[model samples]
Target: MMPWLARSIYRAQEAALKRPTFAYWQALERSQWLDRAAVEALQARKLNALLGVALAHSPWHAARIRAAGLHEAVRAGELPLADLARLPTMTKRDARDNVDQLVWRGVPGGAFRYNTGGSSGEPLIFHFGRARQASDAAGRMRARNWWGVAPGEREAYLWGAPVELNKTDRIKTLRDRLVNQLVLNAFAMSAPHMDDYLAALQAWQPKCLYGYASSVALLAAHAEARGIKPRLTALRVVCTTGEPLYPHQRELIGRVFGVPVANEFGSRDIGFTAHEAPGGQMLLLSESHIVEVLDEAGQPVAPGEAGEAVITGLSSAAQPFIRYRTGDVLRLAPDAATGGQGLHVIAEVSGRQTDFVLAADGRVMHALAVIYVLRATPGVAQFKCVQHAVDRMEVQIVTDAQWNAAAGAAVVAGLRARLGEGVAIELKLLDTIPPEASGKHRYVVSHVPLPAGLMVTA
Candidate 1:
């Protein structure tokens, strides 16, 4: 049950599965030496490899790449980024419509296939193999290392997954404990259930914590409200994913945990895209994937311009995503005169499409404004805003100690300020907010169909 022994066993199993741990480590280490030119060279190699694979086995890519005027001998850098842009972005519907054709038929069977939670309401199934899985894990490990976390260190994962109490799940849980991981159910982020989360953290004493940003922010708020700062001296860093880590949420989490909080931007489909480096730099992991910032017309956005993010995975051969539209907006960092790191920098992520609240003026307002106000309020553990209709909205709250009526009043006042007075605000206390079936926490959910006149100004 020793940590080292558990790691050895896990490594053995991974090796048996033909996972590329050693190769992945070598690639990651090599990335430290990469400059923009070197990254271009590496991407060229990956593109060539991917192109060869696609042409030989993938019917979908074979036809499309040829039609796009891409040649097998062409280097990635030689194939202008704009040339790749001409290939239309593939949506979840495309995959569902052409799953068999999308896959490389030459690859072995049993390649990993998983569905993303589709927080944007368009879930898609994607494929990968053991190699891609291993590379993704190793890339994540490299990011965690930036925060001083090692393989054997104790870590707690606050995540939402189907809880299986069966024999297999019990065995898996036991295995996780041996490897120093405690999984906290993200589905139970309600007020009453928060005590159990606190107790688990106190007992587990993990050195690092990982979870959705909203859930961890709620835990921090809960702890601050109850004055129940569990002696989590074992904890050193907190890594948040699955939702945007607003500035206010980051401040509260860092203050409550007494640790540096790092925001990770990625998805199950794309793997890890960016990690917050030391000294507050958002370093894009270009070695693992290629990212493009494109404007409304699918033209590449200049540095420092805000645009949609398009990504392509270099490691995934099971089903390649070449210039796939990610649907998230991002702003590129200002170009550095010295070009310190080869990795691109992200100035900001506008969060998800799902985080919009329907306003009284018949316009949908982004949830960032509401999140900012709630984080400013005291004694708010966690909150979810749901729009049942144009005029009716429900704000679910989970607090640590007593619910402060003044705090509630302040939130309502803030809401009324942003949304008009005609909008109905209902405050409901919940023990926990359940995650969707695909295991994602939705901050805002609107049942109303997209309005015809609605527009996104920013």
Candidate 2:
């Protein structure tokens, strides 16, 4: 499809859905050039507006606002950005338990229910308004443009979202065609599937390739081992998300694709937060988010210190996540190191690392392949996968009231389908799932190492 026609179709679709994506993108492009003081002023204004909505509609946030004595300040639109720390940080459990108290169902453009990706071992269902949707879409657009890939350009996604991968309807196919996009199922990346994906990518010649960092790196390794040099001359950038892009992974991906690799930092709950620039600097979307690095005691970290990223989503008016503590750890760059923009710079990010599971047939697969199976099962509150051996797998699960014998059957059947019927799956029901020794929740851990000649990096 021609780029012009693709852009036209994309614009029409956004209009039909009443999404303000283009408008938000335009605003973001302009705001990126603002000075630091001006950017903070913008954040203060949006923060105050979002807090006012929470105060009026969200009982959970209202209590905190009043207790912090910021009710009057919020109402007056004078809430200082610094005073945001006065309110206690919110946890995933808080949002899950107080959905009714935290959501404004009557928010403009309506509140839509969605689920987190469960990469952190805690799947959460939350509501977000159209503004949050627009912010995410627009932020991605601006970031892609930074790498010379304009909106609606030819792009291919190496993703495994069940909602999208499960769609076999003609409408989904037509949408992909009209938008000049291709979706390859990363969840089913057997040796043959990876070969097919490489061929499809070469034929399609997309301007950008995007997917989980680990999956992308694995595909690169597979291609290299097979001595298949991909011919993607149109490819300008390989955008990696959903997990941390390790240094070695970055080097392998860039070398294999013959392009620069851009790492995106964000999550399902917070929307699109930041993206790496051409110079390798990660710039936050300052207009839509205010990020603070906090120590273990919830106090702000000093300049140039690594800490937890507690974010305030300005566009989350429907379900305001004022001081939401994201489990991922990061370090902020120096305040003066803005990289010619007002957006905050992130020096380093350490996020969840998923293992590569080896199948009985000797095919290497991304850990998400199995994760999708457990996440789809009913009554699964929390889960952890430990691959004890090639044919033996242990699955620790915490179940809710919805779990039953049928759900247990589903888990075993799903695992068998992916790992081959000969593989043994040990299912253990647990009261709780513990974190790794480093205190990070990794949903998937494999004891089986990668095949020889394939590199696994830290």
Q: Largest TM-score belongs to which candidate?
A: 2
lDDT by residue for model 2 over 1-458, one digit each (tens)?
Answer: 89988988998998888788999999998998888899999999999999999999999999999999999999999989999999999988898789999999999889998776455676677899989999999999999999999998999999864423344655776798799999887766777888999999999999999999988998999899999889999999999998889889999998889999999999888889999998889988989999999999988899888899999999998799989998878888865433578888888888777888888787677787788788777788889999988899999999888899999999998888888888899999999988888877889899998776566465
Provide the lDDT at 441 for model 1: 57
Q: Give candidate 1's error at residue 121 in angstroms.
A: 0.2
Clashing pairs in 2: none
| lDDT of each candidate versus the true structure | 0.70, 0.87
User: In model 1, which runs have C-alpha deviations exceeding 4 angstroms?
Assistant: 1-3, 74-83, 105-109, 334-341, 353-458
Compose the digit string of candidate 1's lDDT tens values, residues 1-458.
Answer: 45577567667756777887656865786685577777767776776676667767778877887877785444343564435566777665566557788786456534777765344433356787665787677777777777777666788998754323688888878878877788876644444456778888988888789987766776777677777777787887899887678888888888888889998888777777887776777777777677788898888888888888888777767888777788778887865313366777778887553445656554434444455455455565566678787788788876655358898898788767666677788998777767777555566777765343222121
Candidate 2, residue 452: lDDT: 66
